[model samples]
Structures are given as structure tokens and as C-alpha cells.
Target: MRGQSYVILAIIFVIIVAIFAVINVDPVEVNYLFGTGEAPLILVILFSVLMGGIITAAVGLVKMIHLQREQKSLQAENKQLKETAGENQLIDDDNNQENPDGKKNL
Candidate 1:
């Protein structure tokens, strides 16, 4: 199912690109800091879109890594807390079994 969804999405993307390319067939001159070149308007648009996607993905990847680290730390802290609570509970039970004379009863 995931593969099928990817295929459908790819088809839709290709159709949209094709429509954009057909509509923007004129060649445009692009001037950069070092040089200048002529490229089709569609290519420019596609390049811009690809660069934006790359940047967004990079930012999202960084955020995901940070969140994963946070999650791992939180999980470790939670386990530690549980263990401490269990130990405290056992000590509480033991103390409750004793009387106020500071000696074990029964």
C-alpha cells in the first residue's frame, strides 16, 4: 500500500511538472555572482522547488534528532524514577511492619 501511494504521488507530481514545463518554455538568463547562464524557466522553477525541499528536510531532520535525544533522556529518567519509587515503597512497607519501639515485631 505504501508503494502504491508513492507511485500515485509520483504520477501526480510528474503531471504537474509537465504542465509547468509546458507553460513556462521560454528561456531566461540567470545571473549569478560568478557567472551567468541561460536556462529554461521551468528548470529554474524546478531547481528552486528542489532547493526549498532540501532545506526544509534538513531542518526537519535536525529537529527530529533533537526530539529523539530528548525522548531517550526522558525515558531513562522515568525508569530511574520508577526504580527509586519501588525502593522507597519497599522501605515504607518494612517500616510499617515495625512498631514505635524501633524493633521488629512478630
Candidate 2:
């Protein structure tokens, strides 16, 4: 449901940008690091949107990779703890069996 809402919002945003871009079809001066150039307003708006999406996706990918690594580390630690607990339980059982008087060994 959350994903569906995001999709719907994205579609609506695209429609709005498309309408805005179409309304301003005049050429405009864009400043670049090296020099300045002239381009249609529609192309400029679309390019900016595309670049923003790319950067956002890249950041999301990095965060996902970090989370995956953290998850694996936690899983390994949990497995180690479980194995240690099992070993301790076995030792306790052995001690109980050896002491027929039902007295716990200090």
C-alpha cells in the first residue's frame, strides 16, 4: 500500500512537471562550470529531474548495501551465541548426571 502511494505521487508529479515544461518552451541561458549555453526550458527541466533521480537512487543503493552488511554481522553473532549456550547446557547436564545426590557443584 505504501509503495502504491509513492507510485501514484510520482505519476502526479511527472504530470505536473510535464505541464509546466510545456508551458515554458522558450530557450533559456544555462550556466555551466566551463561556459554558458542556450537550451529549451523543457529540456533543462527534464534533465534536472533525471539527474536528481539518479543521485537519489545512488544514495539509496549505498544505504541498502550498508544495511545488508550489518544484517549479516548480526546473524553471525547470534549463531555464535546460540552455539555457546548449547555447549554450556550440555556441560550442566553432565555435571547433574555425575552428582547422584542432586547437589549442585559450586
Candidate 3:
């Protein structure tokens, strides 16, 4: 359900950008750091949107990689702790059998 809502919102946003870009079809002067050039307003708007999406995807990919690495490390730590706990339980059972009286040694 949450994913469906996101898809709907994305479609709406794309429609809005498309309408806005279509409405501004005039050529405009765009100033670049190296130089200046003339291009259609629609092209500029679309290009900006594309670049923004690329940058956002790149950032999201990096974050996902970090999370995966953290999850892997946590899983390994959890497995080690379980093994240690199992060993401690075995030792505890041995000590209980050694005590003839139903009382702990310590």
C-alpha cells in the first residue's frame, strides 16, 4: 500500500513537470560556468530533472550499501554470541551434575 502511494505520487509529479515544461517552450539563454548558450526551456527543465534523479539515486545506492554492510556485521556478531551462550550453558549443566546437593557451587 505504501509503495502504491509512492508510485501514484511520482506519476503526479512527473505529469506536473511535463505540463510545466511543455508550457515553457521558448528558447532561453543559460549561463554555464565555462560559457553561455541558448536552449529550449523544456530541454533545460527536463535535463535538470534528470540530473536530480541521477544524483538522488547515487546517494540512495551509497546508503543502501552501508546498511547492507552493517546488517552483515550484526548477523556475524549475533551468531558468535549464540555460540558463546551455548558453550556457557553446557558448562553450567556439567557443574549442576557435579554437585550432589541441589545447590550451586558458587
> Which parts of model 3 have CA positions greater than 4 angstroms off?
98-106
User: What digit string (tens of lDDT, one per residue) describes model 3 on residues 1-106?
Assistant: 9999999999999999999999999999999999999999999999999999999999999999999999999999999999999999999887767456666665
Model 2 lDDT tens row, 1-106:
9999999999999999999989989999999999999999999999999899999999999999999999999999999999999999999887766446777665
Candidate 3 contains a number of clashing pairs equal to 0
Worst 10 residues of 3 by lDDT: 97-106
| TM match of model 2 to true structure | 0.89
What is candidate 1's lDDT per residue for 1-90, written digit by digit as tens?
Answer: 999998999789878977887799799999999999999999998888789869999999999999999999999999999999999998
In order, the Cα lDDT scores of the candidates are 0.90, 0.94, 0.96
TM-score of each: 0.75, 0.89, 0.91
- Using lDDT as the measure, what is the rank order of every candidate, best first? 3, 2, 1
In candidate 2, stretches whose alpha carbon ends up further than 4 angstroms from where it belongs are none
How big is the RMSD of model 2? 1.6
Best by lDDT: 3
Clash pairs for candidate 3: none
Better of 1 and 2 by TM-score: 2
